[model samples]
Target: MPNVPAERRRVTLQRPGPLLIEGPVEVTSENGTTVSSDRFRVALCTCRRSSIYPWCDTSHRRRAGADDPRRAQPPPT
Candidate 1:
């Protein structure tokens, strides 16, 4: 077979939200594992808050009076 470049995808950057891409897409992890989505649009989580690992479940959304576990607090008086 002749050498050819891989297909390029259209990705939309959503601040504080998942990285949206036109699917179906195949994502390969650093450990050599892979995951896929067949939806019209795929949401890849950037904040590591998704229970589905590489996929986004909107867990990054801010909730009322919810304290972020990753934030540093001031010293108590």
Candidate 2:
């Protein structure tokens, strides 16, 4: 049998800096567990310290969307 990926997986980019995930999602971690959900749209925290865990708690507002520039920046000299 051939392997098949979920056809419903999709991602949306928001202007205010929120990534919207749609359809079925399979979130996996090193803990050997995977979280699956059918939520239409869900937000994931990029701040890495979200009080809401996987969801964004608007923590980015504290730094005005500049909390982790180094996260996307190249290695320091």
Candidate 3:
């Protein structure tokens, strides 16, 4: 029997949002920190604003308006 190559993983780039990747993935940072995800799909954060760092916690979502309290606001001084 001929050896078969594994299927290429698929990735979806959502406009103004996270990059969805087929997972069971491991991510390593320059600081030597590593993170692993076993989800069927993982949303990696592109914008540097995720409170969860490399993961998308829906922080990239657009606000409906200035009055949208769901938007991230600065900590109270």
Candidate 4:
């Protein structure tokens, strides 16, 4: 909005977690590719484990076990 100040925003880096940033943010890659978020807050992938890169899906918390969300589907026979 026009009322919003044009200033540097804050980014929070959580230990062993994604970067928490106030959103409506835009991220540009080294190759010039850009990603944008219009959310009020955003969790940026840090561990590079997200299937959706640049966005945190909590994939970094994956553990080798049967209770994992990544194992939602059973392997085909």
Candidate 5:
């Protein structure tokens, strides 16, 4: 079979949100752990709050102000 080159991919930066990238992507942590995904598009997390590290889970959409009622509060002492 003839060898074929992969198409060039582009990345889109969404304001106040995750970075959208064309995938088959592999993300590696500082400790050398790697995670990969073959999705047509991937949302890379910018905010550190994601429970699923390196992937956006909409955790960045939460209100940032203390006045916002939707913000998670600490347990009462």
Candidate 6:
């Protein structure tokens, strides 16, 4: 998985709400700057209000059952 690109990386946002990013990732910006990390499995922010920037800080739980665009919508019954 080391040879794979970060952009190609994908994972599921489970019931617990953590971005389970899988491997060989090198987080970079448009400027080509590398954001170093200790591990390839990273939990990224989705609530858009994390004080920790990219990592989730349990903020999503505060808005449970609401129509959050970030969360996956229920399928049509």
In order of appearance, the predictions have TM-scores of 0.69, 0.55, 0.67, 0.68, 0.69, 0.48
lDDT of 2 at 77: 100
lDDT of 4 by residue, 1-77 (tens): 43467667779998567999988888887788888888989999887888888899988666434455555686799
Estimate, for each residue in 34-60, the C-alpha lDDT of model 2 and write its tens digit: 665567777776655677656767776
For 6-76, candidate 1 gives per-residue lDDT tens digits of 56789999767789999878888889888877788898988788899799899888641265555676899
**How does model 6 score by TM-score?**
0.48
Clashes of 3: 0
Clashing pairs in 1: none
Residue pairs that clash (backbone atoms under 3 angstroms), model 4: none
Candidate 3 CA-lDDT value: 0.76
What lDDT tens digits, residue by residue, belong to model 3 across residues 1-77?
12445457799997567889997677776798889888989989887668997898877664334446666998999
Superposed on all Cα atoms, the candidates' RMSDs to the truth, in angstroms, are: 6.0, 8.2, 8.4, 7.9, 7.4, 7.4
Which residue pairs clash in candidate 2? none
Error of 1 at 5 (Å): 5.7
Cα RMSD for predicted model 2 = 8.2
Greater TM-score among 1 and 6 belongs to 1
Candidate 5 CA-lDDT value: 0.79
Task: Quote model 5's TM-score.
Answer: 0.69
| Model 1 stretches astray by more than 4 angstroms | 1-5, 63-77
Local accuracy of candidate 5 as per-residue lDDT tens digits, 1-77: 11446667789997567888898777887799889888989999887778897988878877335445766889999
